[model samples]
Target: MNYNTTEAFAQELDQKDPLKEFRNEFLFPKNQDGKPQLYLCGNSLGLQPQQTANYIQKELQDWANYGVNGHTEAEHAWMPYHEFLSESMAKIVGAKPHEVIVMNTLTVNLHLMMVSFYEPKGKRNKIIIEADAFPSDKYAVESQLKFHNIDPAEGLLLWKPRPGEYTCRTEDLEQLLETHKDEVALVMIGSTNYYTGQAFNLKAITKLGHKHGAKVGFDLAHGAGNIQPDLHNTNADFAVWCTYKYLNSGPGSLGGCFVHERHANSPKLKRFVGWWGHDKSTRFNMRKDFKPMPGAEGWQLSNPPILSMAAIRASLDVFERAGFDNLRQKSKQLTGYLAYLVEELNNPNIRIITPSHPDERGCQLSFQIKGANKSVFDALSKANVVADWREPDVIRIAPTPLYNSYTDVYTFIQRLKQVLA
Candidate 1:
C-alpha cells in the first residue's frame, strides 16, 4: 500500500478497514466543542469499551441487591469472578488457562512471581535486567534483592544498550549469560521495552537463560495487547502485565500473571500463600489444610478486587470479539503508516528509536526530536493530538487498531509537522 498524506486517503483506508466497526465499540474522548478528540495514546491508556460501564454497573447493582450474598447470588458470581477473566486473558498471552490468573498491579505481580522464581543460592544469586527497564520494574528488582540481603549495586546486572544504540542486542544478552555462566539465578526483561518500543525475542532469551540454569521472566506491560507473545511456546518461567494500557480496562486496573504449566504442580515452588489460593472446595469450610491450586492461581495472595476484575472482564470480552490476531494484523499496518509518515517528514532533528522492522516492535514508535523540548509536547497536547513525552527528548505515539483509525495517524503527523515549523 502506498502511503498517502491526505485526509481523503485516510478516510478511504478507513472505508476499506475490516476492523472499522470496532471504533464505535469504544467511547471516544471529546473536545470542549463536543467533537471526538484524536486519541493516539493507547500505549499509555486505552479508551473505555462502551460495554465496560454496563458490566461494572451490573456488579454494583448486584452488590446493592444481594449484600454479602452477592458472592454466590450475583449474576457473574463474585466468588469465582477472576476465573471468568483468566481463560480469555490466557488466550491473549498465549498461555494455558490454568497457567494464567488476574491479580494485583503489574509491579506487584512481578515481585510476587520473583518470590517464587528468583531463588538465588550460593554463588548463583545475580539477577539480570534491561538497563532501560520501566522504573517500577527496576525498583521491584532492587527491593527484591534488598529483601534477600544482597546489594543491588552488585547483585543486579544490567543488560545495557551498546553505546549510542537505542536497542539491546540479543548477542549482548547471550554474551552476558556466557560471561556470567552459572552465577546468574534469573533473567527478567520487559518483553517490549517502554522507552524504545523494541520487542525482545522471548523464545531466544528464555532458551539461553534456561541453558545457563537460570529462570526467565518477562514484563509484558507494553506487549500484552499490542503483540501476541506465546508464553507457553517461549517456555518462559513466568510473565506479568497490566490491563490499563492497551487492554483498556480503565486506569490502574488489575494486572495478570502467567506461570508455565510445567511448574503448575511443582511441590517445591516457594510462594506466599493466601486463602484464595487454597483449594476452592474447602475454601468456605475454613478447616481444611492449605492446598495451593495448580498453576497461576497458586500464587494469589488474596481474593482479587471484584470491581477491578469486572472491568477486566469487560475489556477481555472486547479482545475476544475483535480477536487478537486480527488486531495484531491491523496494528502492524497502522504503526507502519505512522512510521512512514514520520520518515516522510524528512527532518534531520527527528530519529526513531523503535526498531524499523515490524516484527521487532508493537504499535508504539519512540522518537527523539532534535531541538525540541517539553514545550513541543505541550503544544501537541494543546492541539489535542495525544502522544506521550518521556524524559529528555523522546515522544511515544501508539495508534491502536481497536479504536484508532488511519486518519488519527494522518492528523497527528500534520500537527507534528506544524509544531516543528
Candidate 2:
C-alpha cells in the first residue's frame, strides 16, 4: 500500500489496474490543447459513457420506425423497459431484485417514500436526520412535516456532530431516539453526506430506528454506485438514489427506489395510488381498482421514460461488466492515494475532513483549504484539474473507480502542489 509521488509509480499502478480500461469508455472534457482534462468531479456529474449515444440511438430508431407499435415491438420492449434495469441496479446497491425499481428522480422518490413510511399517529411524529444532509433532503423532510401539519422545528430532530467534527455519530442518533423514542416516527438520512463525504453505518442506523419504533430510509445519492450499501441486509423500510453520480447515467436520469421485502405486501400502509403501480395483468383493464403490485414496482407513478432509461442501461452495463466488488477494491486504493498525497503535503492550511477509513467514505475526498487557498483551487481549475468548489473553503475531488486512473490521481496531486507553491 505504499504510495509515491512519482509519475512512474502511478503509471505502474495504472498499468496493473484491472479497471483501468474503463477510462477509455468515457468522454472526458477537453482542455484548450485538445487533451482530456484530469477529471475528478464524478462526485458531482459523471462523464458520459461512450455507448450512451448508441443506446439512445437504438431507441430513437425504433420510435421512428414504429411509433406507438414500438411499445411492444422494440427489441427492449418499451412497455417493460424499466425491467431491464432493475436487476443490475439491484446488484449495484446490494439489494434483492424484487426490492429495487428504477422510478422517479431522487427527491421525487423521497416524497413518495415519505408518503408511505412517514406515518404520524399521535406523539410519534418527529423525523430524525443528520445535520449535514443534502439541502434537497432537508427540504423534502421539512415539507413532509409541514404537509402532515406538524411544525418542522418541533417535528424534526437533528443528529448532529458534537461541535468540532463534521460527521454524525450513530450513538448520537441513538441518544436522540432514546430521549424522544415516542415522538420519532421516521429516521431519514443521507447514507454518505454530500459535503463531508462521510458515509454512515446504515445497518446500525436502521436497527436503531426500528428498535425505537421509527421507519428508516436512506438517501443514497452519494452512496449508490460508489459504495455497496446493502439495503436488503440493512433492513431499511425504504431507500432512494439518483443514477447520475457514480452510476454515470447522465444528467438528471431516473432515480432508483428500494422497498424492503417486509413492506412489499404491507396492505395496512397507505400509498398514493397510480396506474403504473397496478398489477401488470390488470393494468390495462380500465375499470379495475388500484391493486398495488407487490414490491418496489408498486411505487412507480408512471411508465418510465425510455430515452433516459437508455442512458441508465448503458451505465449499468458498465457496472455489471467491471463488477461492483472489483470497483470497490480500486476505489479504496485510489482515494487512499489521494489522502496519502494530501497528508504528505504537511501543510498547516490543508486538511482532509472526510473520515480516513475506507468504510467511512467513498470515492470523494473533501479538502478543507484554509486562508488564501481559494486561489489554489482556481489554479487547479485553470490547469484543467476538473474538481469542484463548494462554498466557503472546500474543494471536493472524486477519483472514480470505474474511469479514473492512478496516473490521473498522481497528476492531480502534482498540479495541486504546484498551485499551492
Scored by TM-score, the top model is 2
> Which lDDT value does model 1 have at 308?
90
Per-candidate clashes come to 0, 0
Give the per-residue lDDT digits (tens) of candidate 1, residues 286-342. 988889888899888888788898888999998998899999999999999999999
TM-score of each: 0.98, 0.98
lDDT of 2 by residue, 296-363 (tens): 99998898899999999999999999999999999999999989988988988888999999999999
Assess the local accuracy of residue 348 in candidate 1 as a C-alpha lDDT between 0 and 100: 89
TM-score of 1: 0.98
Off by over 4 Å in 2: none
